[model samples]
Target: MTGERDNNGVVGVGADLDSLFAEVEALRELASDSDKARDSARVYDFGIRWGALLSGRLQRLAHYHHRGELTPHEQARYEKLRTELRDVQPLAERLGIARPTIPLEDRR
Candidate 1:
């Protein structure tokens, strides 16, 4: 039950982020179209004037294992994100995200 899919196998926010990545690629291709390049230019000039935000912010179903340890900052962020997750875990569950009942460290 703890994965990118729920007990019912619904895909989660990862899929949504993947779709967003695809949309970004399509937008780039559209910008290269000479005939409608002006139309694309307006959107692109505004949109990518700033770089796109990576989907790295999501913590759902994420593991912080880097050689089996977390840095102090990452541990802090993990604790904070874990606390924040309690608020939205229900909704996140609908999208196929879950946290284990036991802490990962304890589990090992």
Candidate 2:
């Protein structure tokens, strides 16, 4: 939040901008935990590592959607994440936050 902002002040309008940053950081921490857990068991692999990365990114994107300020890329990513999370109900419960729905305008 310490850069040259555009005419809008920040990059763009975010409904819950403050919480967005905090959630993203928490997601990163979760990813780090996933990585460490795998590495500790000598089960670390490219795919698993990438999964952790994707998980973290999805969480951050969800935060953006919750704030009503997702970009085009984040919007596309959100759809995939929502589907994946839906399939893993237990994981979703652990997250304690709902996945984001695509805005009407972004729907096919």
Clashes of each: 0, 0
Clashes of 1: 0
- For candidate 2, the 10 contiguous residues with the lowest summed lDDT are 97-106
Model 1, span 1-108: residue lDDT tens: 233444433244345334434544444454456554455455455345212322232333243333223445444555554454354344334323233342434234
Model 2 clash pairs? none
Please report the candidate that would top lDDT against the real structure: 2
Off by over 4 Å in 1: 1-11, 40-108
Provide the RMSD of all predictions against the true structure, rounded to 1 decimal.
14.8, 10.3
lDDT tens digits, residue span 1-108, model 2: 132345543243232233333444444444447654345333234334434444554444555566655565545545554554444434323433333333323345
lDDT (C-alpha) at residue 86 in model 2: 47
If scored against the real structure, what TM-score would every candidate get?
Answer: 0.28, 0.32
Cα miss at 82, model 2 (Å)? Answer: 1.4
